[model samples]
Target chain A: MIENVTLDISGERFQVFYRLRCEAQDVEAFARHICVEQTIEFPAELIGDDDIRRHVMGQVVSLAPLDDHSWRVVISYAVEITGFSLTQTMNVIFGNVSLMPGVRVDRLEFPDSFLSRFKGPRFGLQGLRDLVGEKHQQLYCSALKPMGLSADQLAQQAYQLALGEFHFIKDDHGLADQPFAPFRERVSRCVEQVAKANQQTGGSSRYVVSLNSPAEQIVEDAIWAKEQGVGGLLVPPGIVGFDMMRRLADDDRIGLPILCHPSHLGSYVASPDNGLSFYALFGQLARLAGADVSIYPNFGGRFSFTRDQCLEIVKGCTDPMAILKPIVASPGGGMNFSNVQDMVDAYGKDIMFLIGGALHKGDATVPENCRAFKAQVAALLRR
Target chain B: MIENVTLDISGERFQVFYRLRCEAQDVEAFARHICVEQTIEFPAELIGDDDIRRHVMGQVVSLAPLDDHSWRVVISYAVEITGFSLTQTMNVIFGNVSLMPGVRVDRLEFPDSFLSRFKGPRFGLQGLRDLVGEKHQQLYCSALKPMGLSADQLAQQAYQLALGEFHFIKDDHGLADQPFAPFRERVSRCVEQVAKANQQTGGSSRYVVSLNSPAEQIVEDAIWAKEQGVGGLLVPPGIVGFDMMRRLADDDRIGLPILCHPSHLGSYVASPDNGLSFYALFGQLARLAGADVSIYPNFGGRFSFTRDQCLEIVKGCTDPMAILKPIVASPGGGMNFSNVQDMVDAYGKDIMFLIGGALHKGDATVPENCRAFKAQVAALLRR
Candidate 1:
């Protein structure tokens, strides 16, 4: 019989403990469910006569309350996994069987052995700040746009944004393998243009190109972007699996910071009191999954996230708990220069302010427009 | 200039049409947003100024309301594709920047020329019914366990259920690659044991295994499972990418009915007047993606979905649509033998009644238990 199993749920580096109680005789089976089952609710097909025969076999034994709102559950089950490898253990914890409802993960104890293997964040907050040469300053960020532009046109926009001394300039998530501006050509042109602007301005304006290829194409794209001398890669982990991001983060050859984009992930945490909380999903999950910068929608934008939710997301990104790495919270969507002061006030100096169309809403020359937006943001942040 | 783009929204499928007015200089960019971006409502970094500019360019020129509460919006845009192959057309529509936010897919016009290349579903409604030989009758479905059952143990239970002649025996969503009954071992053993029972009883009870492997492992798992003679594969398209299911459905070599599981998809349609409705997500989208059967939590379950939502899902599944396919609505969670008659009454004769733990809540052996469950369900249908 297995008495207990341990889990590490990362929330801003703080290791929260969860204990699962297993009433079943098979401890390994119980442990597997604890790791992967999203919730404790069971579907009708899973329970058989024998399952009901030992209905009380899998039940919570004890759950210790953590300092945070989270609790650690401990379960006891008669299952065994003496020779299971880490990968096997991970599969057991998160395998297909754990998708049953009402299967609460009771005991979540993080042993130093398990915690040691997980490299939380390779380049966290300070590392990113150092890379960009910004000390305790709010970073200005913008995105290159609409899919129809040629590589040169997109690069020109990157140059304009870089000339404003913007801290970060990422490709629109839509700018992947399109023939209009193929990824390689776009990355090369944008990186070169940004480099030129950075040389003239003596500022560190990193160009992050979109790496929106599928799994097979992901690493290839990352390696290609790195060869193109791009500062970072913008990845939509939601569309691509999180494991791909983890793999990219682990690769030293792909040494660029990853800007995590939230697309198609609204379904994961859109419901109230169900699925994961926004802070947990965009902030904690993104950071633990190795995102250096996590971008979510700003409140009063076209999206429905509230101001409180946005603030909580920012807190989840920066709050120091365990050895969790801090990530930059980049908020955009319907954001404008007029609200720079408000955004700065709300998110503090260590944030990334992302302004989109409002930067080029009117017919203004790209460089001058970017400079005006930059000046407004700088003046607001100085307050 | 592109005159109009049409979308097939599924209910009253042949009658359903969405026309968009595309005045945008970048018609493909506008179409991409309308199809994918606006639907998911991604954050600003993912969807940038260019996307919004193009979207603003395309207006709803004319909306022709169709039956079944569906409407078609017409949009005229610059640059229509001519003399392009299907792949080229897809590339033009979504290639470079498919993952961006707020990029609504203004149009998804599937011409038979392109649709002919796709296999759609190999074992759609009639094929699956033919395999089971249970004509004009609602099917009885149940899950294997919550979690923690070993391969031998799961096989024994599966054998007993097979003896009782369950139309469908599926893995609980939680039963992924867990250690207790590793995926390959569990699946192999369960399929063999069930096959043996089928041989004995001259019954056609089928086993549907959950193929929740990561993106890279998905195709391999599907192929492997099919080779192993598993009757069907359960796919939670939401957790995995939606395209994976489409690929599986298109695979003629693996002619298995794909059971769509709504595990982490609550966030997409959980809210009213916000995201897609339940019918749209579970019904139209799932069907369009090639789900022969769609599973959702029944009204009285622990989950918050209402009777109306369940009914809508069924309507979406069975209503006259393009290449009308029968999608068995398997409602579980807090459902049991006691409510078989009521369930049959509500959902009618074309439903798949799924009863989980309650079937095993008594001291009856697996065969006897399943027998009693089948008897009750049969009696209800007769009544």
Candidate 2:
């Protein structure tokens, strides 16, 4: 059936190059286990058969020993196998083998044939900048926090933030459709307040509400957000499937800039040699999955990401690849006003600094705190 | 705004008790970090506010030091916060903290009020038994594999296995609507073949096709599968969202026995001191999402699952809980016709033994191998 199975390394098939840490194990046996577990879970004899080996089994392109105990193996699969869907592509890459210990997905290589399947980001870096009308300086984004606040209270906070120097105001990932503030009511009020603030300040400040709900409702709410003319939409691809983000990006009816939040997704990258690289998980994959702005925790912040990890995330967002455009790397979670200069130096221009609690701190008002954070970043641009 | 926030530990709120391995660290500070990361990503001073603390903050119910390093911490969240949705529930439990190291989620305790939102397993153990018409014996399931085979060839294999003894015939998790054999054609042919084989052998073999596809296509294909009289439907909740399983389970119109496959979800359970427990991920969560049968890798097999982990999965599947019915605990991956007795001894009855490669091995034909597998399990019952 696989009459024209290509063995050429530079072929059209999108490849997932996995960097597995095979500690003192039989490299060949481990490779076979990965190949069989991922693709054809059949007998050895059947897999040994040339036809099955060529067509179905994953092609082991290269295997190099990293140390006495680890091996850096590169295995490539035909794009036809994955059907170019993000969900199936992930299954082919790490579905069954995820059960195995010490195997990490360090690199992912996708040909244009595969990349063409996804819309990537609708309003990518340039488009988002164009929308905000801030072409020169780095962006400042913040989330409405202390989630017990009612819809009106949250909206008032959003208004205050918008009145300040914040370009993007978002609902905290925890602020789902609860009794205190339902989805429709919360989204409507917040968007309206930001709009009012935008009109008063004569600045483009967008309020992106979280659209993470049930599947059908996800689409419905996204459409409703578009209808309401909300500046952008926030979706947690970690909680919802990554493919759902692609679907949202591809949907012509719901044309809105998407902000992808990393909630319930840290397990994939927390381990050193088990799950995924910071660049791959938060950067490349998030961009490919149609995240206009990818929000993760800052390095000096309360979260456990290292400075190098943060830099890699930035590179992954802006790295030149195929036709895919670069996305905004928005880092937050325990970020404060004091660290803005250091963060600006670390991430440079084209970054979105997401400071939450710090913007609400100090003797000054929330807007004043926001102004100070913005001024600090703008001063760095002048330097 | 938070009118009636409860401080009582014995309230209707759901609690997730995590056994974090914080080595020689400040236990209270670490606990507050988790609480803040999971809920309000704000300042400690803001969190210390009584109104915000009582209403929004995740309460540290108990904290006890373990050994020189690790600590056992119990945290509780208001059920109203999650809105009783599975997506929101997971977010509240581990969303941001999953990014942090050494924070393993050991226990999850949900009240009946929270659990009542989900319809756990429609058919369950007894319903599956009634469907197969085998009341007392253990179920034998097989995957039609070596994925490159055409639809006709795979269907022929399914027919052979059905004629011999397989109670449940499923597509391997890898087999999506690939170019070799598209989903609709393969599913239609396999169902017809199994139905024909069932008629010939006077057996009640059920062909459960994999419905792992795009979101919209998933619902459409489920409807199509029902129209084609498919016996059961298997969904990979890992690839799609867990809420998709809930959606499929809640759909009364389709009403096919749903089998939840644990593909692309291993990262959550691979780490010892992080992510989720085996019982919670595979057992409790799967059942709550409406998995009539939950499939996971068996211990003493090709996979890395330990014996204790496998047992916990069984306990999770069959544990006593509200009105939710107990589902079948299917331990699979690299199982064989030889290990039937050992598995029976370990899991006893009410288990589904899924053997793939081994069934296709030995001098016996595929059907003969299936027959031998069934006989081996049946002989255990004779004891």
Candidate 2: stretches off by over 4 Å: A1-11, A47-50, B1-11, B47-51
Model 2: number of backbone collisions: 1
Q: Kindly list the per-residue Cα lDDT of model 2 for residues B1-383, writing each as its tens digit.
A: 22333232224666777868775557788987787778766665654545457756788889987767788899988787786687888889888888788887876888876787778889999999999998888888888887777788889989988997689999988888887788989988999999999999999999988877876578888888888978888888887888888788878877889889988788898787788889888888888888999999998888889889999999889897677899999999979766777798898888988888787776788889888888887788789
TM agreement with the true structure for every prediction: 0.74, 0.96
Question: Given candidate 1, what's the lDDT at residue A109?
Answer: 33
Among the numbered candidates, top lDDT falls to 2
Q: Pairing residues by index, what is the TM-score of model 1?
A: 0.74
Off by over 4 Å in 1: A1-122, A133-136, A176-205, A211-230, A241-256, A267-275, A300-304, A321-323, A361-364, A379-383, B1-58, B61-119, B251-255, B320-326
Q: Write the per-residue lDDT of candidate 2 for residues A1-383, one digit (tens) a residue.
A: 22222222223555666767766557878886787778887665654445557656787878888887777888878777775677788888888888888788877888776787777888889998899989978888889877677788889999999999588999998888877788889988998999898999899999888877986578888888888878787888878888788788878888888899998788888676677788888888888888899999889787789899998988888887587789999988878767877788898879888877777766888888888877878888788
DockQ of each: 0.13, 0.59
Error of 1 at B317 (Å): 2.3
Candidate 1 displacement at residue B25 in angstroms: 29
Tell me the tens digit of each residue's lDDT in model 1 across B1-383.
11122221111111112323334444444444453333212333434445333432233345554333333444422222211122222223332222222222223434434344444556666777888998987777778764656777777767878898988888876566755678899999999999999999999999999777754466788889999989888887655545557667767777788988876566455434223456656776577667888888787654557788789888777764546465777787668766666677788877777777776665677678788876776777686
